[model samples]
Target: AQSVAQPEDQVNVAEGNPLTVKCTYSVSGNPYLFWYVQYPNRGLQFLLKYITGDNLVKGSYGFEAEFNKSQTSFHLKKPSALVSDSALYFCAVRDFWSGGYNKLIFGAGTRLAVHP
Candidate 1:
């Protein structure tokens, strides 16, 4: 089984400042990690993914994440935050189940607040 943990329930930042949401995971094999953002009452929107290649991967809306294998962590980061960036962020890991199905296990989620 695969599992993920998001230690922070919420992260607050002022507009135009860098923000980070932390995540950690544990999986059997090589991990497939991902990040998604959700607006109020809306489904999650894909942010970025780290399947292979460089440790750092960029994604939609100027968001990026660092995949640290040793630490088993994939933390989301942005250089500058926008007031609109305030949303709920989720960390996920793809798992291959015994039934031959691939599924995503999401973290508890972190709420980001960017005050103007």
Candidate 2:
């Protein structure tokens, strides 16, 4: 089955420091990977996605992710963390079967806490 795992329950980092949210996925064929951020009382905002080319893909809000095919990993990264960046992060995958009415499967979810 195609799925994603976010090993960390939460990640704490000081403001202005780099931040990373780890994610690993398993899929039968080429996977469509996506990163989304959710703030308090707000819907998830799309950060980025890895579709075909470019191992390194950049996304919204000064965030980016590296697609490691060998490791089957797609980790979200940011050079500097902000208090506003402290939110819930989710790693998701869409398989070939995920079309029409199919939905995106997400990880358990990771909380990012940024300390000022």
Candidate 3:
């Protein structure tokens, strides 16, 4: 049972707008999407991963993510938005019951307000 859903708790874009932080997932066999970004006290910063050949997955600062296996979704994009790209955004999968290590099943944090 792998699940992730960031149905927006907050997302406001202004500074050169073009930002989306919405993720939806529910794994059973193959699904490994990830995107993390947190800055306030700074900790979880890894902004991009789709784990199996392209569906448009780029990483780091000017983030990119689009792995839509028929809309099971993995959407995190930033064409412009900055204000230091305000923080707190996460969407994860891959928690194969902790045996494969690197366990992750998160998605309840999306607060990115890049205004001016």
Global CA lDDT computed for model 2: 0.93
lDDT of 3 by residue, 18-114 (tens): 9989999988767878888888987998877898998998888778989989889999998999898888998989886667766899998899988
Which of the predicted structures, 1 or 3, would earn the higher TM-score when compared with the native? 1
Give the range where candidate 1 is weakest over 10 consecutive residues by summed lDDT.
Answer: 94-103
Q: Which stretches of candidate 1 lie over 4 Å from their true place?
A: 98-101
Least accurate 10 contiguous residues by lDDT in model 2: 95-104
Q: Per the 3 Å backbone cut-off, how many clashing residue pairs does candidate 2 have?
A: 0
Model 3 alpha-carbon drift over 4 Å, by segment: 1-14, 17-31, 34-51, 58-63, 66-77, 82-88, 98-104, 107-110
Q: Tell me the lDDT of model 2 at 12.
A: 100
Error of 3 at 54 (Å): 2.6
| Order of models, best lDDT first | 1, 2, 3
Any residue pairs clashing in model 3, and if so which? Answer: none
Alpha-carbon error at 62 in model 3, in Å? 12
Which of the predicted structures, 1 or 3, would earn the higher lDDT when compared with the native? 1
lDDT of 2 by residue, 1-116 (tens): 88899999999999999999999999878889999999999999999999899999999999999999999999999999999999999999986586643368899999999999
Worst 10 residues of 3 by lDDT: 94-103
